[model samples]
Target chain A: MNNMRVLAEEEETSDGVEVTWEDQQQINTFAKLNARLKGIEDKLEQLKQEKEALDDLSTELELTDEDQTVLYKLGESFLHLPQPDALVRLEIDQASVSSQLAKLGAVAEECERGMKDLKVRLYAKFGKAINLDE
Target chain B: MVEQKFPESLDKNPRGIPKAPFIANVEEYIGGPDGDVEGPLKDFQDAIAKYRYMDGSLTQRRKGLEDKIPDIRKTLQMVEFLKQRRDRKQKADDQEDDLEEDDENSEGAKKPLTTTFELNDTLFAEAQLDDTDTVYLWLGANVMLSYEIPEAITLLRSKLDAAETSLKTAIEDLEFVREQLTVMEVNTARMYNWDVKRRRERRSAEEAAKREKES
Candidate 1:
């Protein structure tokens, strides 16, 4: 077990690609960038879903009377609505939702731009012959 | 449904992975005489190269798993949030009913009061959350699956578990490779020592033989 621990520590110490293997280092970096790109893509997908869901829910809620009682979960618990005025829990505000959607769109655009830059760097390192599509 | 336009930069590697070089014989280099340690020397270099490659691959795999685990954990957190919201709503409903009973004689109690959400919070997107019994799970590589709330939770839990297990396995494999490299290092050192000693012995023997001939 002690030997294995030492081995494990040694492995951890050399976890990064060695500088001697220039090609391998480049390839490993490409992999890391690829993973990060995937993560950003996932976030973009999620934000799109959230915006869509919010739009659908807002349209559905607007068709009803403003004072109509609805279940609103605020914080940890749901608050009861006796009057039509105080919608303390519902997230049905139009301006706020629109801003959120716009913000997400901008973020997605930024991520795409970053990905493009990363690809350019990768191509520069591996050259045109290196197939990034594989 | 919104159509997804995947970024072009996220495309796959074009050239694919290059193949690693193979070493034919490693053991033949060991336990050889002095001055003929070139085979063992080559073997030592090959072993170091192989170890580096293995370590590099394992490192990448471990990093991938690490990234995946946190994302799955975030999914789990969302699931827990939904569950808590539902439970809170149920509790509130029970309390409202109890209040209605106490104010049975009042005109305000004529209609059962229902609470709906309406907010303009900066931290969260403002949108009415109708009770949902389902959630969408991202299954990686641009794949998303819709599952019932309970099912989504179960799936994420399993995914997190699987990712953790894979990470553990990769670490173990890396350690094993490191151990092999260490053994190779020891063997090379011992072989060099043996070669040096043999050369000294041979030089002394040659001197004794020449001296006897001169006598």
Candidate 2:
């Protein structure tokens, strides 16, 4: 029990929660992060017990109603957690590509303006509408 | 009806739960005989039963108090994180503006030209707050702290709506929990009182003193 207590990051909260979807998410996220950190939180102790649980089948062991719930929770936790390293690398590459595309767009606009300026300079000096299009 | 979302329903799983003993303990604790008592439960069923009236009163107060603390602490967390984010973002934004102004000049000694572009503060404020803030905050992003104030204001309006549901449900659940704790305290006090009463009646003053405890 002491080891479990040591593992959990004890929050010095004195009150129970005021239930809300937002609040529920906060609590669950806390739990999931705790799972990653192996936080010796009060709930994790409860979870550890479930992990090693026996015949009740209603918890984390096998397929029971509760087991269904825990697995789903684990899935949700994983889903919300940041993407895997490979996926994150891919995302970074995509972002770099997009930023370069934007830079290209800005360069294109600047070139268009520069071309217009050059066209006026040529017309001013040559004093003729040369068929630049040809 | 407002959506009733409990921890069990949080993750949408169609599979199963484990048969852990701790889970059973938690379940039993929440669903015990005197555990569900509400509204300052009678002293006889409480842990504070050693005290008949006045001491039982203190025990009840303590239980009622324990309920608001978590909410208060959470609210405090929301506030502190927001303040920190707001400061950091504001400083960074100010620095960026200065840097942009510097870029507009080739020579550092040249007088900075004032631009006619006036930024609308309201636009900036609105842009900071949106639905994604909550998820960001939940994911523990410190940057979302910058969105705290505006989100709080915007969330307040919707909260009035969601509050009707969340608060009602929260209040109901709070009341239920309060009752359970209150009864436990009171029962404890009452049992102490009964023991003391027996000792006093039997002229065993020392035993009475042993049983005499604060609720």
lDDT winner: 1
**Per-residue lDDT of B162-186 in model 2, one digit per residue for the tens?**
5345534443333333333343443
- Residue-level lDDT tens digits of model 1 in A1-134: 34544554464454342222344344444444454456457655766676677667656666767645554443323445433322322354445446756775675566456656656766675464456663
Computed on alpha carbons, the lDDT of every model, listed in order, comes to: 0.56, 0.35
Poorest 10 consecutive residues of model 1 chain B by lDDT? B1-10
The CAPRI classification for model 1 reads as incorrect
DockQ per candidate, 2 decimals: 0.09, 0.01
Taking all chains together, each candidate's TM-score versus the true structure is 0.45, 0.21
Winning candidate number (DockQ)? 1
Candidate 1 structure lDDT: 0.56
